[model samples]
Structure formats: C-alpha cells, structure tokens
Target chain A: MTSPARQLRGKDERAPVALSDRAMDNLRFIRETMERSASFTHVSGIGGVAMGLVAVAAAWAASRTTSDGAWLSIWLGAAGASFALSAFLMGRKSRAEGVALLSGPGRRFAWSMTPALAAGGVLTAALARGGHFGLLPGTWLLLYGASIVTGGSHSVRPVPVMGMAFMLAGVAALASPPAWGDAYMAAAFGGLHVVFGLLIWRKHGG
Target chain B: MAASSGAVRRRSLEPAERAPGNLDAVHGRTQESGPLELDQLIHERVRLGIVSALAVNGSLTFTDLRDLLGTTDGNLSAHARRLEDAGYVACKKSFDGRTPRTEYGLTEVGKRALNAYLDHMEAIIDATRE
Candidate 1:
C-alpha cells in the first residue's frame, strides 16, 4: 500500500502548496539541529525525591546512633539506596523515551559525574580513618554538589542550579559547629533533594 | 508481484531517485539552478524527520523512529524502505534473543544530501530576506 506520507505528497503535488517547499525544509533543519544538540533527558525527579527521603531517614537514624561508626553506616546505606533508585528510575525513563541508557548524552553525563563520586568516597574513608568525622558532612555535600554540577553541565539546566544550591549548603555546613553536621546534612541532602526534585519534575516533566 | 516490480522499475528510472553515488545528475541540476535543489526523497515531512533523526543519532531502532515520529508501523516501514533503496540509509536486521530488531543509520551519501539540503534552504532564506 502507498503510505499516508505518499498520499499526502500526491495531494500536495495536485495543489498550490501554501508554504514553499524550501521554507519547510529550512524549518525542519532548524528543528532537527536543536533536537540533535539537546542533552539526554532521562534523569528522574521522583528518583531524586526518593533519594531525598532516604537521606532524611539516614539523618534521623544517624541522630539516634551513639557511635560515629553507626552514624556513618546509616548514611552509607542511604547513599547505596540513592544510587540504586536513581539508576532504576533513569533506566525506566530512558526506555520510555526510547533512548538507550548509554546514548551519547548519557555517556557524557556519566563521564562527567564519576570522578566527583570517587573523590567523595576517598575523602570519606580518609576522614573516618583520621577521626575527623565532623568534616564528613561538609565534604560529602561539597563533593556531591560538585558531581551534580559537573554532570548537570551535560544534563538539563536545573541540575546545575541544584548542584550550586547543594554547594552553598555544603559551605554553610563547613563553617558551622561540628554538632550541627546532622542538621546541615539533612538540609542539604534531604531538603534540597526534595525541593529541587520537585522543581525538575514540574519544569522538565517526570 | 507484477505491480510491485513495475513500481521498482519506475523508481529506478526517476532522476531524483538516483542512488547516492550517482548523484552527479542531481548535483548537475543544482549547478544549473544556481542553488541546490532539495532531495525529494528527503523532502517529505515523515521522511525528513527520519533522516534528520538518524543523521544526529548514530543509529536508531525501528521502534525508536516510530516513537520519535509518532507514526504507524506501516508508515515508518514504507518510508524507511524508500530511504534504504535510495542508498541514503543502511539498515541492519538482527535478533535480540527472541525478537527481531531493525536499526537504521544514515549512509555517507545520506549525510552529504542532508547537508546540501540544509545549505540550499539557508541560501533560499538568505536570498528572500535580502
């Protein structure tokens, strides 16, 4: 069967086309260029919210712990949950969008994000070893912020802004007293995640 | 079967339907016109979208193109076949475990044609604006 596209072409040929064919071509070219240059948009707002909730719970759990080791374990558990949730949600979004998980923009996002997370891990270990656990909150927030900012450079726009907000919270955490670490972590990771995650969902879609 | 073969023969004879490497005739026409003429094969909206998407994305599955263009399977398949016949696109058919998967990518000539088409459009816009 002649396709609908072919039928449409036949009709156009029999009539005086309203838009000159050349003009149509120009429009299509502009649109396609823009589409091609856009970043991968599979990041999930719901995933961010989920991570935020986990962070908040981790903060609450850490507060109840008597030892720094137990506190670290709770936060570490939150980190693992966040990673898994983010990956699962991102994969779902990619599939829904018909984009591969390892597409060009996705690869760029991953490449830009890995180093910051690695640094965060190294710093966490070293700080814990040296018993300078109070610095952990600031370092975590700063590095996480740096990761988001760097990755967001390759992702949608709001991500970098969120990253900057996390960085500012990190700076505040650093300057505050050691006793305030849990509260600052809660604000940065928990509050910021929920707020910005909602913003991303509203602006960029789920 | 006879009708299908006849359609193929007609497609083969059309000047605009020339294969990619044999684009000298089309280019010669463009040189005569002062600006390149757009490839009618790539000019239609659905076809244009398919080529444009493939030009940017290294490769896309049949489902990917269908979803991107919001077209029916029959529609996408027909258009894709036309592009493939023109030597403008390369198609790879494979099995992903239990299901068949078809992927499409722009051929080198296809890329050249798209670039030329864009340049022609730009030139027309420039001429009209002036």
Candidate 2:
C-alpha cells in the first residue's frame, strides 16, 4: 500500500500550473488554505477557553452553593476540549508549509483580539462579583465581538464588520440596560465564535 | 544511494566558469540550457534544506546539517544520499569522538547547480513581473 504522505507529495509535485499563463490563481488557494488553517483552532480556542472560564466564573458568582461551581465545571471542560482538539489539528497542519503557511497569515493575527476579549472578561467578572446581573452578559458580547473583529483573519468575510456591530451593541447595552443583554452578549461573542469556528473547523476536515 | 563522488570530482576538474554568487546561476543555465541537469533531483523539502544549507555554507557536518534541517538521523542521511547521487552534494564520515559523524558540502558543481535552480525560479518570477 502506498503511504498517504507519499501520495500527497506526489500530487503536490504534479499539481499543474500554467507556465505561460501568468496566473496567480494558486496564490489565493494557498492563502485561503493558510487562513483557514490558522484561524479555525485559534479562534475556537479563544472562544472555547473564554466560554469555559466564564461559565465557571458566572456559576460561582451566581450561587453561594458549591453546586454552581460543579455545573460551571461541566461547561469549562466541554469548551476546553473543543479548543484543545482544534489546536492540535492546527499544529499538525503547520508541519506542511507548502500546504499551509504559504496560504494564510497566521494564528497570531487572531491573538490581536486580546484587548476586546480581556476587556469583556474583566467587565463580566466584575459584574458577576458585584451582583450586577444585567450587565455581565452584555459585557461579554461586546468584548467578544470587538476581539474577533480586531484579531480575526483578513481572509474571513464579515468578521471585522460583525465585530464592529457587537461593539456598538455593547455600547447600547451599557447606555441603557435591556432585558436581552445576556442574549446579545452570547450572540456577539459566543454565538459568533461558535458559528465562525465551526465553519473554519468543518473546512479543515473536508 | 550511489556514492559517485568520482563523477562529481571529475566534473569539477573543469574550472567553474560562473561568477561567484548571482551570475553563477546564469552561467549554470547556459551550460545545461535544457532539462537534463536536475532530472534526477526531485526538489523535495529536506533535499531543499540540504541544498539550501550547502549553498549558504560551502560545507556542513551531518549533525550540523541535521540540526539545521530539523530531520531525524535516518531521514537526513537518506535525503543526503539521494542528493549525493545526483552530484548536488557530497558527504564524508569522520570521528567526532568514540562515535562516528558525517560531514557534507556543496561542491563547486553543487554550488553551480543550486545557482542554476535559483536562476530558474528568478526567471519564472521575472517572466511574471513583466
């Protein structure tokens, strides 16, 4: 049986380019592949780790009872695992540079999101601790959106605009407390992350 | 796998006609001009590493090249052997201590070959640029 790597390398060697065609078509494919490779796990990891940490924190902040911590622990583990799996897969792709690195910019591009995610997390933690139940969720959404937009890859469509929208919504929530603050937060950060992360992750497998 | 250092040594007996760095590639192209020079060489990553490392530094120890190239001992040795057969690089063994070690280098011919390969790439880019 032929080795899978051998087959892939052979295909890579044989993959045609139009010698006379002055075509940079392969450049887009390379960039898209690289962008998807870097963004999926990194974005997922951020969302996953953030979700896990917040769930546990929120649960503790909500109840005086230990049961809340236990409940929170479940979410932390689930999200953490998803983050880890994505991270591992992304690492594997890095070894094949012709296939991945030449394609996209990198995960560090996603790392630029620190200001937004951190700002959101800190605000949420403070709100939860202070018993300001209404603001905690809104803060998370705003921050999540802001971070994703700031740190997200250029290759992905609509990430920056969506992030801007979330920041705007967050400002609105703070200006006037609303009944749907939590939902908005989830929509901005958690929902957007899960949605985009899943889209990128699915592309990796297929 | 064939240790045909003799072929490479004999080829290098003719004093190299190319300029040291940039035009070495151009002169190399004129010599081969067709598809025959690198026919046996596959231009794989590890081999690229060996060729690249040799091009920059005229010689390297097997351990040094292994470290620079980031490959397992067997993997480095295998790729080095292929390049050696193609007359693109040369490796020789010596004692580092009680243990044995190997050293490799790009011969003048190998340097000419790498220059030729790079010239080909630059030509492609130059063609696209215009």
Candidate 3:
C-alpha cells in the first residue's frame, strides 16, 4: 500500500492557496513538521530494545558453536559489536540530549540495516558453499526498505523516503542481475549507510 | 497583530489553533480584528499546556506547571495572565511566612472549553468512522 507519510505530503500541497494567507501556510508547515518529528523520532523508534536483543543473540550464537565457519563467526561478532555500540550511543544520546536516538534518521537506518545485514550474512555463507550470489543483497534491500517505509509511515516519519529510494535501486539491480551480490550489498549497507548517516549528522548533529 | 500589540512587547508570535470547532471560528475573526476573544485565551502553547495538564491532573501548582512544560517564571506568568484575563483558570497566590506559593485550577468556563474540545475531536472521529 502507498504510505501515509507520502499521502500527508501530497495532501498538504493539494490544499487550496485560497484557504488562508501565507500565515496559514507557515502554521501548517510548523505543525506538520512537529507531527512528523514526533512520529518518526519519538514513537516509531521504540524498537531500540529489540535491537539490544539482536546484539545479545548474535554474541550468543557466535559463542555456542566452535564448528561454525571462522569468517561467519567473525561476521556475527561484528554484527553484535555494531548493534551494541549503536544502541549504546543512541541510548546515551536519547537520555542526555532529550531527543530519542532510536527515533528519526537513526531508527530508519537501523531498520534498513537489520534485514540487509542478516541477508548479507546468510548470502555470504551460501555463496562460500558454491551458489549463484545474485539476488540476495538486492532482495534484502528491497524488503528492508519496504518494511521501514510501511512501519514508519503510519506514524508520519519522513526518513522512509530514503529507504524506498534505496529499495527501488535494489529492485533494479536484482532485475538486471548485478555481477556480484556482495558488491551490491556493500553499496546498499556500507556506502548508503555512511552517506545517509552523514547526511543525518549534518542536519541533526549529536 | 493584536496578540503582540504595544501592551505586550512579544515577538509577534501568534499561537495557533484553539479548541478546533466553533471556538476556532470565533477566535479567528476576533484575533484578526475585534476585541480580544475568550477563544484566544488558552490558545497559546504554554497556557494550552497548562490547561491540558490541569484537565488531566485536576490541579497544579505554579511550580508544577513550570516543571511539566519547562517554561521560565516570566514566560509562564505572561501566558497565565491571558488565561486569567479570560477567567479560564482561577489562580490563587499566597505566602506561608516568607516563601511564595501559587495554585491554579480550571474554572467552570475552562472546563466547558475543554469539554467542547474533546467533543469536537469525538465528532471528527465519528464522522470519519461513518
């Protein structure tokens, strides 16, 4: 389904110019901005607790099985480290800064990264065992983006646009069949993440 | 223009949206060009916060309102004046020996305005449901 966040933006502009003076426009802008901020940042990011759980599970999974592939174990360790560190930084930012970390751009990034990271880990394992590594990363991105957009929009987050855009590119990549799935996954997770994270930091710095 | 006229050297910041129904129509015309309207009374954010909080809490002291909304003394005092002017809330100031104290609660009029606002919200939801 089309997202509510997109609908809100379109619905806003469709209102007649004759409705009120420029003053009305200004008020609407302020109110909508506030509402969207509250939805994306304050309400939607309540999943930091779940992210904490993922960190624990990754650490435990890495510990329990010595026969697991060494590289796979390392990847799981990195996932655990990154998730714990992100959650820690976010938690500190939320409490100290009074602006919740799990909300807004941070939350959006976390949501997008989760499925991509998971699929990447799985695909890396499967590819090492001799299989076509074409559709995994793209599928991960497409699904992750669509999920974030769907979940975030109900609460009025604007960050889902970023997710949707990345997902669309992922769709194109998969349809055209990229030469390497790992490269595509790296682009979606590492490159796209660094870029969007920097953008968010610039716009709303810690 | 009127909300920030000479009497109150404010930043020309007109607060947006009152109780969202007939109350808004009354405030719109009056705030534009007429005597100060009662609908304009609790529209300011701080005052509205005070009212909404009190509506939930029954009563709040001056310090309580200040702590809840994080407004400075002078900032809250100015907005409280508007509410008081319209008799939306009854503010009582007192002194126990040396320290100062103040308590505020919704007046009959304030209760009615809050009720009207809730009713307006219910009507909108009901209409959407239909």
> What would the per-residue lDDT of candidate 3 be over residues A24-115, giving only the tens digit for each residue?
44344334333333333322232333333443454344445454364255444655665566566557656765665665544664565566
Query: Model 3 segments beyond 4 Å from truth?
Result: A1-37, A42-79, A99-133, A154-158, A176-179, B1-130
Report how far off residue B71 is in candidate 2 (Å): 42
Ranking by lDDT: 1, 3, 2
Worst 10 residues of 1 chain B by lDDT: B1-10
Give model 1's docking category. Answer: incorrect
Q: Model 1's chain B TM-score?
A: 0.74
**Candidate 1 chain A lDDT trough over 10 residues, lowest sum:** A11-20
| lDDT (C-alpha, whole model) for all candidates | 0.76, 0.50, 0.52
Please report the candidate that would top DockQ against the real structure.
1
Give lDDT tens digits, candidate 1, residues A174-203.
999988999998888999999888888887
Measured by TM-score, the strongest candidate is: 1
Residue-wise lDDT of candidate 2 within B6-107, one digit each (tens)? 111122112222211222222223434443233225235577667766664446788776766568999988888988987878778889688987788877
Model 1, span B1-130: residue lDDT tens: 2222221122222333351222222211333554344477876777888888887667788988888788999999999999999999999999999899999999999999888777645543443332
The per-residue C-alpha lDDT of model 1 at residue B27 equals 17
- Going through the candidates in order, their DockQ values are 0.06, 0.02, 0.03
Query: Which residue pairs does candidate 2 place in steric collision?
Result: A30-A103, A31-A103, A34-A104, A141-A185
What TM-score would each prediction reach against the true structure?
0.57, 0.38, 0.37
Instruction: Judge candidate 2 at residue A49 and give its lDDT.
Output: 34
Can you write out model 2's per-residue Cα lDDT over A28-143, one digit (the tens) per residue?
A: 33233323333332233334334434544433433443343443344345436645654554455554333452233444554667676667667756765786756655565567
